[model samples]
Target: MKVLDLQCAHQHVFEGWFGSEDDFHQQLERGLVSCPLCGDLRVEKKLSAPRLNLRAAREESSATRPEGVTLSNHPAQAELVELQGRMLKAMREIMTSTEDVGERFAEQARAMHHGEIERRNIRGQTSAAVALELLEEGVEVMPLPMLPAVKDTLQ
Candidate 1:
């Protein structure tokens, strides 16, 4: 298996593993690779340092080892799970605190921007075109994946 470092258009860096360089290139060409953070498909390969395995030749120097450190074989998995947990918690907080404006997201946002309505936190569904238009108009908005329980339709 080959491990390679990759960065998306949004500059979110992550590692991908493949059977070979050809496999990686094939996946990239097929648009199968994407950024986990923002789901961006425009990914680029990054230069990575080579790893050498000499475990059988010599034991790790005790002097250089960190004190009371225990390493996990699946460190990446643990970190990923923790990060996901934190992200979910933040998303939950936002969903709970924001008003569900349903399908009138674009209208409400525009009203707030034009000072026709009071500015407040809101969550709702909007088309990609609408979101782009809002951004182009200098209205700050973020596209967040809402949890099923936070569906604006029920609001």
Candidate 2:
């Protein structure tokens, strides 16, 4: 397996695993590779160093390193990466748990609120005005910004 660092046009960095360099190229050419954050297909491979399993070196470094010290040179970047991962995981959970009502979100929500339909977990697109109206009418609704990648299954 080959692990490569990749970046999309939006500058979201992620990793891609492939059987070989040829396999990666083939997938890219076929438009199968996309940004997990925004689903952008304009991806490029970034320069990455090979992974080395230097257990003794790691143990020595950690022994002398200060407490609370992270491995990343940029702490903020590491935090951002962590946050992105969390957000992606949460989005995936939401997508899997909620029923998509599409543009009929408002209608369905209103029905459920009025006892015309059963209340259940749901998610969909609605205009800002409609969403506000729903809230005003005591229909509980929360806006979730749906990522394009979250709408499709990622390879």
Candidate 3:
């Protein structure tokens, strides 16, 4: 397996695994590769050094470093990446657990809130005005940015 660093037009960095270089190219040509954050199709491979598991070297370096000090040169970038991963994980969980009510989001939410329909987890699109109206009516609702990549399984 080949792991390659990729960046989309939106500058969201991610990793793609492929059987070979040709396989990666083939997928890119077919528009299968996409940014997980924004679902942008314009992706490019980034220069990345090969990962080496040097446990002894890591141990020696850690011994010299103070406790609570991180090894990442770009700490902010590392934190951002970690945050993005967490957001993606939470999004995946929400997507899997909720029923997509589509444009009927407001109606369904209202119905469930008033006990007219069975309460259940749901997700969908609604205008800002409608969402506010729902909230005013005491119907709990939250907006979730739906990325195209989240709507479909990534290759």
Candidate 4:
């Protein structure tokens, strides 16, 4: 298996795995390679430093992290991890500050949209039907990943 660094026209960088170099070429020629973000097909390989299979060289750089955590002492990589943590922390703060109506998300959202309830930040569960309904009603809603909550209450 080979992991090749790739980039999209939007400057979003990502890595793709292939069985061989020819496999990557074949996939690209077939127009099957796509950017995971925005699903853009107009992706082109950027000129980058050549890859070395040595473990030390790979570990020397900080960009190999599939997740935010890393076991390397690379300062560049540490900065990336720190930035990721800050972003995640900011998102958690927002989620914790918002009201959680749970399954009543759609109901509460519509109520607020129609002036039946006070407008405020809220977070909760909603079905596809509810999401579509909210969109039809011009209610601004955004789907977010499940995030960790703030430990405001003592267990």
Candidate 5:
């Protein structure tokens, strides 16, 4: 059975199961789809996951993962999950107390270094040139391995 994520004309989301893609198309074209929330017939596939063609010939060229084989999930996966949980918790605590100075990282750091501003925790973005300039001025700055892109959405 093939499972599909479907969205109605009214933006109501639902899932549909079918024997094949052709069966799904046939049912959809005949207005067989009914939105669970509003009971609307106008529905379309929202995000259909790529169907892996399981043709025997194609299988020869592709490296198939053994069904029983998995990662060292018994203990390592648990440890990794625990580590992630701890990191997230720590980050949440820090973000709540820490101040975000945005893009004026260099200027803010300079002010703090020169005692123009009170010394406190600050986070922001800066370019390589700005960072180098700060270093030349003997301003102590180290790059943090920030996970998320705080600047803006990628174009």
Candidate 6:
């Protein structure tokens, strides 16, 4: 397996694994290689140093890590991760407070707006057309992104 450092036209750096240099070229020619972050298809190889994994015979105190915590060397990435955590936390709070009305979100929202049902916080799945229609009818609704993994974990 050949692991090469790849960069997209957007300047997003990532790794690409290939069977050989020829295989990498073949994939690139076919537009199969892309930036994972931005989904850009214009990717090129970047200069990379060979990786050497050496097992230490002894432990080094300087290389020790604290329990239950992992540290990132990139400051920007660390900040982004922290921001993402905060956003997810806020989203989770919103999800907990809102009732899941599923596909009836549009109907429920319209009913509430027309005083046919008591107004309450709700979250659900609805087509873009339905959401637009709800908005047109002056029924307020906020779109909530549902993460499949989080859905199973939510109480």
Candidate 5 lDDT by residue in tens digits, 1-155: 87876767866455678889899999988987666545678888765435556676346533454443232222543454456546545555656676889898888999999999999888778998899889999998877645331222211
Error of 1 at 88 (Å): 0.4
Worst 10 residues of 6 by lDDT: 65-74
Candidate 5 Cα outliers beyond 4 Å, as residue runs: 1-73, 148-155
- With a 3 Å backbone cut-off (N, CA, C), the pairs that clash in candidate 4 are none
Off by over 4 Å in 2: 60-74, 151-155
Question: Each model's TM-score, in the order given?
Answer: 0.50, 0.76, 0.76, 0.46, 0.44, 0.52
Give the TM-score (vs. native) of candidate 3.
0.76
lDDT of 3 by residue, 1-155 (tens): 99888889987878899999999999999999988899899999987656657998778877998764445324555566778788887898899999999999999999999999999999999999999999999999998898766666655
Off by over 4 Å in 1: 1-73, 149-155
Assess each prediction's global lDDT (C-alpha) against the native. Answer: 0.74, 0.84, 0.85, 0.70, 0.67, 0.70
Between candidates 4 and 5, the one scoring higher on lDDT is 4
Residues 47-132 of candidate 6 have per-residue lDDT tens digits of 75465454451133226854332332245544554555466567767778989888888888888899999999988899888888
Residue pairs clashing in model 1 are: none
Q: Which runs of model 6 end up more than 4 angstroms from their true locations?
A: 1-71, 152-155
Q: State the lDDT of candidate 4 residue by residue for 76-124, as single tens digits.
A: 5456445545655767687669988999999899999999989999998
- How much does each candidate deviate from the true structure in C-alpha RMSD? 9.4, 3.1, 3.3, 10.7, 13.9, 7.8
- In model 3, residue pairs whose N, Cα or C atoms come closer than 3 Å (at least 3 residues apart or on different chains), thus clashing, are none
Worst 10 residues of 3 by lDDT: 68-77
lDDT of 1: 0.74
Quote the lDDT for 118 in model 5: 97
CA error at residue 51 for candidate 2, angstroms: 0.9
**Highest lDDT against the true fold, candidate:** 3
Q: Write the per-residue lDDT of candidate 2 for residues 1-155, one digit (tens) a residue.
A: 99887889987877899999999999999999988898899999987556667998767766887754444324554566677778888899999999998999999999999999999999999999999999999999999877876766655
Give candidate 1's TM-score. Answer: 0.50
C-alpha lDDT (0 to 100) for residue 69 of candidate 4: 47
